[model samples]
Target: MDSAAAVSFDANGTIGAYQIGVLISCVLLGVTTTQTYIYYSRFPEDPAILKALVAFVWVCEVAHAICVAHALYQFTILDYGHAERLFSRLPISLDTAVFFNALIEQSVLGFFSFRIYTLSMKLYVPILIVFLSSVRFLASMVTFIITLRLPSLQSYNAHWSWLSIAQWSTSVVNDVVTTAALVILLYNRRTGVRRKTIALVDKIIVWTIETGMLTSATAIFMIIFYLTMKERMIWLGAFTVSSRMYSNSLLASLNSREALRSMNATQVSLHSFVSRPGIEILQTTTTNTVVDITAKFPSQPQPFQANRQCEEC
Candidate 1:
C-alpha cells in the first residue's frame, strides 16, 4: 500500500474511538442536566452563590457537548470518504472543546477545594488542591493552543506531548489529593459522634472515594493510552468522558445532601423514641405503670406521674 493508504487504514481506529467518546460525553450531558434540575428543585434555599455555580457548570457542559458533537460531525459527515483529511486537517471544535473541558474541571475543583477548606477549617490542603488544579488547567490551555498550531494529528505526538501528559497528570493528582482530604476530614468528624451520625459520614466518605476514583481512574487510563498508543486517538476519546465526570460528580454530591439530611433526621427520631425518659423496661417484660398509662393515653399533652416526668407524654 502507498503511504496515503497506510495513513488512512491506521486512522480508522482513531476515528472509531473518537466517535465512541463523543457519544458517551453526550449521554453524560443528559445526566448533568438532570442533576442540575434536581439541585434546583430540592435545594431552592441554597445560597445564591451555589445556585450560580451550578448554572455556570451546566452551561459549560452544554458548550462542551456542542463542541464535541460539532467536531464529530465535521469529521464524519463534513469530510466523509476522505480519511486523508483526518490526517491533514485539525478540527477547531476539537481544540475548543478541550478549553471548555478545562474550564469545567477547574471550576468543579475549585468548589471541592473550598469544601475541603470549610470542612477541615484548614488552609494548606485546599490551597494545594487549588494549585494543582490551576496547573492542570493552564497546561490544558497551553496544549489547546499548541495543538491548533500543529500541522497534523501525527505531529501532536512529536511536539508538545509533554503538555498533554502534564495536563492529565495534574488532573489525576488533584483528584486524588482532594478526595483524600475530604475523606480524612469526614472521618475525623465521625469521632465523638453518635453511631447513626458516623454511619452518615461513612456514606459521604464512600461517595467521595467513588467519585475520586472515577475521575482519577479515567485520567490515568487516558495517560496510559496516550503513552502506549501514541499514534492513536484513544486518549483523546477518554478525554471527552473525563470532562463530563467532573460536572456529574459535583452535581451528584449536591443533590445527595437532602437525602443525607433525611437519613440523619430519621436516625435522630428513632434514637429519641428508643430513649424516652419514662419508658424504662425490665428483663421480665413487666411493663412500668407509666408506660401503660402513656400507651393508653398516647394523645395526652401533659406529662404523666413517674419518678421522672414522662418526656414522651
Candidate 2:
C-alpha cells in the first residue's frame, strides 16, 4: 500500500488495497481453472460426487470473479473520480461475492471431512470439521442479513463486525484441525504396512500439510490485515482470494491421486541367496494363502497343491 496511493481514492476502485485483492483473486481463479482442467483430463475415473464438487467450485469461482469485476467496473468506470464512492457500503456485486466464499469453504470442508472419515475410519474429527464449517457458513449468512438490515456500511461494521471475525476465525481453526488430523491419520497408517504403503502415506501427509497451510495462512492474513489495517482496504483482496485456495487445494488432491496409483504400480522386491549349485530363485504366487515347494531348478513352475486338492478334496 503506497502512502500517497492509500490517501488517493479516485478511479480504479480505491486502487490501493481493494484493487490488488480483486486482481489477485482473478489470478488465483486462473490457477484453479488450470488445476480443474488437469483434474478432468487426468482423472476421468474419479468419483461422480468428486467431479460434481469440482464443477460446482469452478462455477462459484467464476461467479466470484465476475462479482468482483463488476464492483471494480462500477466503482472506477461508472463513478470515476467520485470521492464519495471511494468505499462502497454494500454493493450488490460485492455482497454476492461474500456467500460464494461460504459455499466454496463449506464444500471444501465437507469434501475433506469425508476424506478424514475414510482415512481415520471414524466420525469424530469429521464431525468437528463439518461443525466448524457450518459455523462459518452461518456466520456469513448472519453477516449478510445484518448488512442488509443496517443503514450503512459503517453502521453494519459497527454492529456486526463480530460476524466477519467469527467466520474467518472458525475457518482458520477448521483448517488447522483438519490438516493435523489427516497428518496424524497418515502417520498412523505406517505401522505394519509395506514400504510402498508407507511411502504413499508420506506423500499424502505432505500434500495435506501444504494445502492446509495455503488455506490457513491466507485466512489468517485476511483476518490480521482486516483488523490491523482498519484505515485501509488492503485486507479486502486477501479475503477475496482466500476461497480460491480452498477450492484449488481440494482439486489438486483429487487430481494428484494419480501419483498414488503410479506409486503402487511400481513393484518392489527383495533378493535372497538360495546357495544351490547354480543360483536358484523362487517365484511365489499367492491367492489368500501361501504355498512353499522345494524344487531342484527354480525356473520350473512349482505347482499349487492346496488349490489342486481343493478342486475335489
Candidate 3:
C-alpha cells in the first residue's frame, strides 16, 4: 500500500482503539460515581460542601463520558471525509463539545483538590489555588480552540504547546498544594501519635499522593504523545485512550466506597470505645479514733558484761 493509504489505515485502527478506551473509561467513571454516592449516603452528616463537590464531580464525569462517546461516534461510524465535512460544516459545535469536555475534566480534578483542602480546613489556600488553576485551564482552552481552528495540522501554531505546558504545570502545582494540605491535616491530628491512627493516615496519604502523581505523569505522557504522533493518528489515539483508562482506574481505586466505609467504621468504633459509660467512685470515709496504747521496755546486757570482765581479769 502507498504511504497515504497506510497512514489512513493506521488512523482507522487508532480511532477504533480510542473508542474502546473511552467506553472503558466511561464504565469506570460510572462505577466510581455510584460508589461515591454510596459513601455520601452513608455519611449524611458530612459537610455539605464536600457532598456538593462530589456531586459536581459526578456530573462532570457524566458529561465527559457523553462528549467522548459522541466524538468517538463522529470519528468512527462516519467515513473520514464525511466526518470531516460535517465537523467543518459545524465547526463551532464540535469544537465546543471537545473544549467543554476537557474543561470539565480539569474542573473535576480541581474540585477534588478543593474538597481535600476543605476536609483539612485550610480555607483560604484552596480557594487561591482553585482560582489560579482555573485561569490556567481557561488559557489552555483558548489555545486549544485556536489549534482546532487551524486549516491543517501542518499549519498548527506552537502556542498550543505552551498552553499545554501551562495546563500540566499548573495541575502539578495544584496537586502538590493539595497533598501538602493533607499532610498538614494529618500532622495536626493528635490521633497520628497512636499506632492505628498513624497507619490509617499513612494509607490515606499514600492514596492521595498516588492520585496526584499519576495525574501529573499521565498529563506528561499525553503531551509527549501529542507532539511525537503528529503524523501518526493511531499513536495519538492510543495515547489518548491509555491516558483516560489510567486516569479512570486511579480515580476508581482512590474513591472506592469500601475504603471510605472502612474508615467510617473505624472512626465509629473508636468513638464508641471512648464514650462508653464507666464506673465512678462517689464517696470516701476515714476513721481516725484509736483507743489502746502499749509501752514496751528495753533489755539490759549488764550481767553478761560483768561476767566477761571477771573472766578477763
Candidate 4:
C-alpha cells in the first residue's frame, strides 16, 4: 500500500478505538439512566411500555458495545491481512449494530414523546410520530445493509454517494418532523385556553421536547461530522466520540434522581391543586370571616358615654 493508503488505514484504526471508548461510555450511561428512571420516576403510569423502551435501549447499547469491542479486538489482536479478511467478510456486523443503536435511541425518544402525549391527552399524534420514526429507522437499516453488500466494498473511494445522501436526508427529515411536532404540542399547551390540564400537559411536553431536541441536535452534528470528515480519522473520531458522549450523558440526565424528583414534585403540586375542591371558596370565606369579626367591634359612642358619667360622678 502507498503512503496515502497507509495513512487512511491508520486513521480507520484510530476511529475504531475512539468508537470503542464511546460505546463503553454509552452502555454505562444507558444502564445508569434506565435504573434511575425506573426506580425514582413515577414509572410512566404504564410500566410495561417504559420497561420495553428501557430494555430496547439497553439491548442496543449492549450490541453497540459488542461491535465496538469486536472492532477493537480485530485491530489490536490480529495481523493486518487477517483483520482485513475478517472485516471484509463481516462488514455488515458493525454497521448493522450501529443502525440498531440508532433505532433504539429513536424508539426511546418516540416513547417518551408518547408518554407526554398520553399524559396531556393528545393521544392521536403520538401514533403518527412513532410510525414516522419507525419508517426512518427501517430506512437507515436498509441503507446500511445495502452499503455493506455493495461490490468493490474494499475500495474506500467507491463513492457510495447516493447511500450517504439518502441516509442523511432521511435523518434530517425525521428530526425536523419530530422537532416540529414537539413544538406544536408545546404551543397548543401554552395557548389553548382550556382547563389547567392542558397547562400541565404543556409542561410535560416541554420537557419531552427539550430532551428530544438535545438528542436530535447531537445526531445532526454527528451526521455532519461524518459526511465532512469522512477521510480524516482524527476529526471523525473526535466527532463521533464527543457526539456519542453527549447523547449518552443527556439520556443519563433524563433518567437521573434529580430529574425524577423535580418531575414528581411538579406533578404532585399540580394534582393537589387540581383535585382539591372548594379550595378557592374556602380561602375567600376565611378572608371574609376575618374582616367581619374585625368590623363587629363596639362603636366609640359607648366609650364617650362612660367618660361623661365618670366626669359627673
> Highest lDDT, which number?
1
lDDT against the true structure, each candidate: 0.72, 0.68, 0.47, 0.44
TM-score of each: 0.82, 0.78, 0.64, 0.59
Better of 1 and 4 by TM-score: 1
* Ranking of predictions according to lDDT: 1, 2, 3, 4
Clashes of 3: 0
Q: What is the lDDT of residue 197 in candidate 1?
A: 44
Who is ahead in lDDT, 2 or 3? Answer: 2
Local accuracy of candidate 1 as per-residue lDDT tens digits, 1-313: 4577765566556788989998998899999999999889976755566778889999999988898889889878997777777776579988899899999999999988876654445689989998999888888888789879988877877777888888888898899999998888667655444454456667778988999999999999999999998777788888889878999998877776555544432111111011111111111112211101001112222221112222222
Error of 4 at 187 (Å): 4.9
Better candidate number, 3 or 4, judged by lDDT = 3
What would the C-alpha RMSD of candidate 1 be, to one decimal place? 11.0
**Candidate with more favorable, higher TM-score: 3 or 4:** 3
Residue 213 of candidate 2: its Cα lDDT?
96
What is the alpha-carbon lDDT for the whole of candidate 2? Answer: 0.68
Model 4 misplaced regions, further than 4 Å = 1-17, 20-46, 79-92, 116-128, 151-159, 190-210, 233-313
For each candidate, C-alpha RMSD in Å? Answer: 11.0, 12.5, 21.2, 15.6
* Residue range 15-107, candidate 2, lDDT tens digits: 456778888889989999999998889756544655788899999999989988887777667766555554446577877788888899999
How does residue 37 of candidate 1 score in lDDT?
A: 93
Model 4 TM-score?
A: 0.59
TM-score ranking, best first: 1, 2, 3, 4
Question: Which is better, 1 or 3, measured by lDDT?
Answer: 1
